[model samples]
Target: MSTVDNPWELTRAIAPRRYVNRMIAEADGVIRSNSYPSKYPVNGNPPTTPWAMDLTSLDGRFWFAAFDLDAKTPEAFEQASEDLGVLVRILRDTGLPHVVCRSSPTGGFHVWVPLAGIDKAVMVQLADAARAVLPTLDHGMLCNDRTGAVRPPGAPHARGGASTVMGGADDVDVLRTPTVTAGDLLRVTAAFRELRPTVDPADSSPTGPVDARHRAHRSLPAWGEAHMATVAGGRDPSRTGYLCLLAAAVSGWTLADVEHAAKTAPGMEHYRTRNRPTGGRERRTAAEAAARLERQWAKAQERAVLYRYAPEERAQRDLTELTGIVDVVDAMLLAFTASPGRWTRTEADLHDSTVLTYLAWLSLRTGSRDVAAALRSVAIATGIPSSTVDRSLRRLHEAGWISRRRQADGPNAAIWRLSGRFSTPGEHVGPLHDVTARPPAELFDVRAALLEVLEDRITAGRHDVFTRAGLGPTARRTYESLTTTENAVHTVAERAGLPRGRTRAALASLRRYALVVVSAAGWRRRRLDYRTQAAKKLGGKVHGALQRRELQYRDERDLWAWWQDHLIRKGGRRGRDRVPTTQAVLFRAEDERGGPEAYPLYPCSSDGRADHQAAMRFVRGGLLQDLRDLELAA
Candidate 1:
């Protein structure tokens, strides 16, 4: 039985590593002391098909982890066994996958693959294919869900969990890894949930043995082919506030449930480290001291924000002092700013480089779908290894970061959408619009109509055509009487069917369906000021850049150099501080011909995915190398 203090030790123990066998051997030296009789049922051979999935601890407070499995561990290594059952059911014809675990904190899980005679890779392929209809799942507050599901970079509980497949009953199977039980997940969840936001990072010294009870139960008497091993890789990580987050997902509790419990838990009410009850000043002297402390603290945070703040900030205090927390926050901010995505490096993040790299890989991979040389190009750009990339992707799928589905052909690329929930586009952790894109099918009708209107406008009867569209009737009459003698009565009345009070709604729908333009023209039709969404993000980046004077190589004089460095190639200069026009493409396709042969490809907007893929396919097939000299000269 795991408790609130060490809710994830089991996870850390079981997480996959480059040398998993070695790590398990080392952990066994000490795990024997905590061992107990198993309470969970075991389906070692997986009478039914099996699949495994469970959460991993990233920041412990801000993120979650997940992975999939096909076989159970030998024995005594049941970790996240129960959660695996839930994940497995989505991939096979099983209603619930069996779970196996020892205690529960940080131990890896083993799932018995179905006896379907499917190859290991094929089983994984099938499991990936049948994963939940959506590409994300909820593993408590920590979500190792789909990539590019934008969230506030620094916000907590931003990920949407793992990808959860939903289709046939028991499509996913859950076999035990080291012979543990499923209910243990619930038990551990309950225990950890007791403490939350109260566990201040400043006071959390989560680096020791937690003597919790071992609660295990197993029942698979009907199956004869069960094998178990006394392996030692389980538990996840610390779960103070992290535990409270799980309660919401496990019990379907409201955000209110999580927020209240976590925010007011013991050991963290004020969440102060060395300073306590400084809530209100007791005496005049204390009050003055408090004021000075506030000023100093504010200044310290500023210093921490600087890119190289680790030395000064880390030396200032221990974990118990709020200084430690200030330092951690500073680190998180820096990590977030450097790379805006699913995971950022920080002092508080879990010390699992593999997991972090895997998360980054997903973010890059998902967003670069249209880029032909995506994987290889990004490897060069970021200096990451291919094996690390491959492993991370495998683990992420197991954990539910994204889903894998069979392509229409032999090998299929899994399609991932960031946690498929209605989160405000980018309103995740810090500040970014993370809205889910609306499927194009739903907006087809509206878009089709709008396109017709645009095509008709080419005839040139009257330029100001809003009034005739029932958008600006009064304004329409004014324009018509002033511009041309021809009357647009038919056009005006036909569109006038739009409800009187719903002019704005109609226009909004049109815009959503890609049917209307929202320039000065749309404003005139709706009789509303077309306020542009605040460009806070762009402004913030610019402000930060200027303050740091980081643009050292900016081309202040040469226009061509400036255009290439930035993704722009057209338009006059906007100003020194602003980019003129972000025309991303510079040269036409095949422009290397060096003459009019490629001139027809002018107005260099890329052919997007198609052209790039053609180029890459040629490269992949060794065609590029064969014609390298000729192509280069052309």
Candidate 2:
């Protein structure tokens, strides 16, 4: 019987696809692979077993594509981009009855679960469980470049660059050792484990033509030339998942032959190809994205400046993030800050229990400041070996946030100091001992700052809306009481219990006509600090250049108009005691003898000179602004 409707359909259908006998044929470049599960048929049996697994990525863009061995579309990859919230919500609420794994993508996350581990009935159950759980997602805010921070688009995607986003078949850095060992195999296995994130092994390789289907898809020279950031923490390239080996290759087959296995297997060619890259409108849209990044960077920097209290002369009165910083640099800061607190270290576990205990004990001993000091004293007094403290301190010091300040007189013990700014994220710090070092977030410090910003915004009613935008309840009340009950800046400052010194200063900042002002004595307080028409934001470099270009163009226009007007009003060389205003306007004789003649208007010359030809065009153009070519071209 044909297997379609049979309970044994999946088993019979999936059997000859790749497996031979009771064993599965190894691909050309596969180093390690756990058993993949599915449902299938055996002989004429009513039921059979097959295998399957599904995965998701965490780099922000969401997907929940699945692979079913029984179907014609085994490695078919389909995405639910805007429905990220819906899919993740489904997985979170209605747990699947299968073994699962998770991976991180550039934007969001992914979930990996094997289908064979759970029976088809349970899989159906899982789907039913999620029927009520998936929420409708509104992704209007999650469009191109709307993330409100600078993200590198990666060098404008040069001609013939990789078109599709692909991951490695495995994330293994290959070895050049003379001798192979069990240690090497384990390391190799761990490396490829990361690459399974890709739908195709090509995902782990370069963009151009693939010589072999299942071969290790790595191009080292290409990587070097492109200057890509492959892995976090500067992992050694060889140890990276840029390459993989085919551990299960059939004996006696050439490497070329083995690679052909994956060529037709799960992931073949799936990337969509358009007629061309983009449109003219797309170019304009790209610019808009670039503009938004500039704005967000500026805003984040403006915040930094406000936090730093930069003076008005240095401060731009815009919605920018910081004051007196380059646009891109400020962008980086905002992008980093938007992540909020650093990535915290995983919870203490057996692998690091000793280290955590040692640190905990050390925290107590090293401090003369209250608890820390008391703990340190107890550790030292109780005869906990000083060597243990030394080792713990060494790792902590290496983490950068902590430093060892040794005394010259020398009890010879290390005095570790935490030199981190609260703003200095912990994700950057906690990675010291991590095989893959990454910082741990210091939640306390970050949460404190967030609270301060939220409280005031809530109370003021200034924005008129706050909750959806993230203002705290206390902030709302403070805004209300300050405006309604205490109207004057000083009075409001008093009622708000602001520091005396800061209150006056902050009031001064708010009171400037361009800044803010409060009206009413006590009934209702309204804010008056809004942007003036002249308050435009531009980056430091481009700001000056664009402004200069505008000013120069304006001056030239005025000069041309003024010369015309002067001839009209005074006529040529009238017999009067005129100050020669037109001549003075054209030129001042400090540097040159003759007015106007010293810098005569560039005359149109259709002669052989290139400069003259350009001048002729400009003259005929009537000093047009060329709104078409202006950087702010409409």
Candidate 3:
């Protein structure tokens, strides 16, 4: 095979007859108008901008299969490069002809294999077979019909480079490459399956005696079984069914085992008849239904490789479980707070502690430590921004308080578990105090009330009301101590499991907002609408502070933009070095000026360029407009 002289011709030849689309990219590699059915130029010659094409033709036949290997970091890029070699070897072994290209300026790659017009179902099975062998393959690409368009070869990558042919095959004619037939794909799939040893469910004894760990590995965990059972009544039956297959795969079950279990499991009855057409007059035959199950099982096995449980993790899973919310709350309080008083030493410490407490409560309420919650949900519950919540979760993970099982994707939330570090509470920390006077059974209800109160306060112009109203960790505990009745400072301290000094300060802060009132009888929560009153009291000061912050942000943004322009003019230096140079200049000036407000654009130690990018996004997201609206309301 000889690479074509014009890559655009290759791209045109590969794209579907209809539904070719165009996409534009920003300087920073962010794509705009990325959705499907976008406008594509009529004349070929490959538009100056990036473009995408549907994988399937108008007739619903797949013309090619592509794998996108995205690498976000240098280490990942190196690994992806290695994996690319493995993928090429696999294809060569299967006697399949393919094309390879550098997908971006970064070390990401894309490999496209031409296929004769094949049914989508057969294409999917071929993709799954490849996925089982190559875990790094992007499963989202060819998994469904509505997967949207993919940037074709010869297109401009969003990340500031052209997608160019790789592997010294520039002379290869991509358009004339030989295509794999459906029969060839099926043969390759069978060869791939042969690589894995098959397990039989009917035989109690294997060739060798199975140990306890091996036996455990071959059966679904309690949680997996529960998730699988959800298929019976879940709104999204397909998702639950996939989860079941994933569970089976993670438990080390083979395709045969999964098929057998699906045939027998009560919750999986629907899987037995999945071969029925949407409105067909007759049901599919038993053999056809079994074949359908085999295909799904193969796909799930591929995806499950990423989530397989490690030996240590399997042992630690039991230790992560909690008996009830009380146990979770007590464990978190003990692990996060300082001894004797359960008090946090600094604001940052307090924030982490509060976030952990909230996550623990959520886990217990869900009857599992594996809590799948979005950052937004946690932010709303804790009265913090989503970014801050993310940071707090990372901190908790670093501190051995939690372990993230899976990162959130699309509509799915991240799954986190209270780790084995705090499995056993140190000792009875004293009678667990119920400051909200809420019954332990009403965990979610109390969370709803807290969210409502927080929303009202924020909407009325009081941001971070929890901290502003002296509801810091210590203060919140103190205030809760007085929920049932008034108490003296020392008594409140004891009830709140805090130092007397901390209790007194909390009471003073609460009293300032009239959230709690003090008299000769001690301090008690005010009977009035505290949320409304607090918002009213803090609105002016909060808005003024926000306005000042916005002004500073605008100044920094303008300065950064100016610096970029200046650097571009001076030496035309661009890409990675420019950002570090700009940040260095800003830092030097900040040192010379010597003040808290002097270098507002200075990079944070934890995240250098990311901090600057966030500031830019903050301005772009219309925070300034929101501030103007607030000012007008005032």
Candidate 4:
């Protein structure tokens, strides 16, 4: 074949230096390859063997925004070909340059649009816009940043035939010519936006007059109004406003309706003001505020498309009964606690168990196995930090104890569902002996009784003890287990669902405070008042340990604050230079002695040190209670 006609040359035009290859054989059914990219001479002839080109470069830039369409039979292939024609017409109408190729002998199609060094996220969005029109497009091809390789034109397919350009060498020139720029992609996205169906209030109810529509928007739910009025530290105002607008949009409110509600709502005064350049707030003109509301209203409409509720659905939601399944969930927790090997082997494992148990309880209390909760909400409910709760959720999902059904979006918490192991009746096999099969009683307030049971098992209701004693979940759980009965270290570890070493260490710590005692049989708790005994035991040698630690933490925080001020004063240092220096100062106290190890840092480099100091402050605040509790006990 000539240079323009050569399949390898055509492939090299789009991905010249980075391509993978595989041996062509019928037995090689899988798409496995250990091949790495290597440079090839641009002027050289095509390689003798078939090769595939990576869609994304090593530096995370996309060479082409591509789509694949496959069919299992000839009839399906014909149908797919018709859909391909429709897609081609759409692209042609939008003036997007593209290339089409027969990807395999079994009749899969690959459509490629050359991109000018576009990022993966933007490329995915462009593809999504196209997929909205053609739903049959295979999403896996560009589902993530690390998209797999595609067999280039002229490359041999393992199944039989070689990939061929659809219009032959005539259309191959587009791959090497001027490509689709970001501006072009944006224009196409805008065109696709026009194709999206307009929101219809008729789906909610009969089309109403302008005043009737305003009345509908004014009927905000209690939760929606609360979200709009909430103003708290660490909260994003933009996010709060967007969620409030989304709540209205999903309820079938128009843009005018949303703006009117924002202006008239009692607690929505913040929406009328804009920050000045001098760092002072000023009330915006009506036109300026309306423009801002319009932008937010558009975003809310796009996001709430999937969640929009009909009139009946919204009206009946409040009337639905909240039947509690505390009995069933309690049984599930009992079973999970008894089987330590299934969920627990380490301190982190115990945390995952605790989070999973709490999620089950929340799900049952809501009268469904599906629960919607934010990380902060879960943290508040379980007394675990938000960061730890996030990790526990990941672990629970990975271990098949729970699964996230939907991600959190505007005004909506993430929806999580208990797995079959907990949700399915008669599936929990443990010492509970089929307690989950029993009929649940209707309890008016299950929270108090449920909390007592959880505290007895996992110390879930002991935030005060956690703060006062500086005890983490694992240590608290071990202590709770010991309080029930005297038991060997191994037995206590089993009951607490912790590692033997951690259980032993907890025992030693408690013994140091005279809260526990060792005997020939096992370990037992002392009957004396724990706070008084602990105070008297630690009064002398360890009396000032907490104060010293607090001082040290405060000094470290001050050092970080000074560094930040120094950077601000200097004013010319880049972020790269500031982060390492700030981090060094923040962690300067760490050495051979025990210090905060594995301290969680914020992902943003600029705020990482500040966030670390905030965590330290929280720790020091917790220690204040320790001192006060000890003094009172003494």
RMSD of each: 31.2, 27.0, 30.5, 28.1
**Candidate 4 residue lDDT tens string, 1-634:** 1223566666656673454544432355453332434434435666544556777777877767667766444433533554465456456667888877777667667777777777765555555555543334565575345746677666776546777666522376777764788777767655544332222222221111112212334666644555455542002233345556766876678877777767754334336754221123467688767766775576466444323211111211321233224545665666655777665666677667767766765554345657776665555445555677799898878877778899976336788987656535435566875453311111322322453344344322233333333545566677767642346788787767667997899888777766676875477655332533354454443334433443554445434443444344346542111122112323323322113221222212465334455544544454423332333334
TM-score of each: 0.19, 0.18, 0.33, 0.33
**What is the TM-score (0 to 1) of candidate 2?**
0.18
481-597: candidate 3 lDDT, tens digit per residue: 563234567777665566788778877887887777676646766544264456456665543343344455445545455344434434544311112212222322223222222
Compared with the true structure, what per-residue lDDT tens digits does model 1 show for residues 444-501? Answer: 2222222222212211111122212222222222221211111133322223222223
- In the range 1-634, model 2's lDDT, one tens digit per residue, is 0112231233233232222112122565331222333322245443211222112112332111121111011011111121222243233333332111111121222222222222222222232222212112111111111121111111011111211211311111110111323233223223322222211122334322333323233332332212122221011121121122112111122334324422332221111110111100111244433332233233322222222211112222331212111222223224222431221122111112223222222232221211121222222222122344344445544655344465322112334443323233334555555543211111111222222232222212222121212222223223433431224544554443443454445444334323333433232232222322112331233223322433444444434443443344345442211122232233233222122222223333367223444543553454422311232222
Ranking by TM-score: 3, 4, 1, 2
**How many backbone clashes does every candidate have?**
104, 67, 7, 0
Computed on alpha carbons, the lDDT of every model, listed in order, comes to 0.25, 0.26, 0.52, 0.54
Q: What's the true lDDT of residue 91 in model 4?
A: 66
Task: Supply the global lDDT for candidate 3.
Answer: 0.52
- Native-to-model Cα distance after best TM-score fit, residue 164 in candidate 1, in Å: 23
What TM-score, to 2 decimals, does candidate 3 have?
Answer: 0.33
* Best candidate (score: lDDT): 4
lDDT of 1 at 492: 28
Residue 210 CA error for candidate 3 (Å)?
Answer: 24
Predicted structure 4, TM vs. truth: 0.33
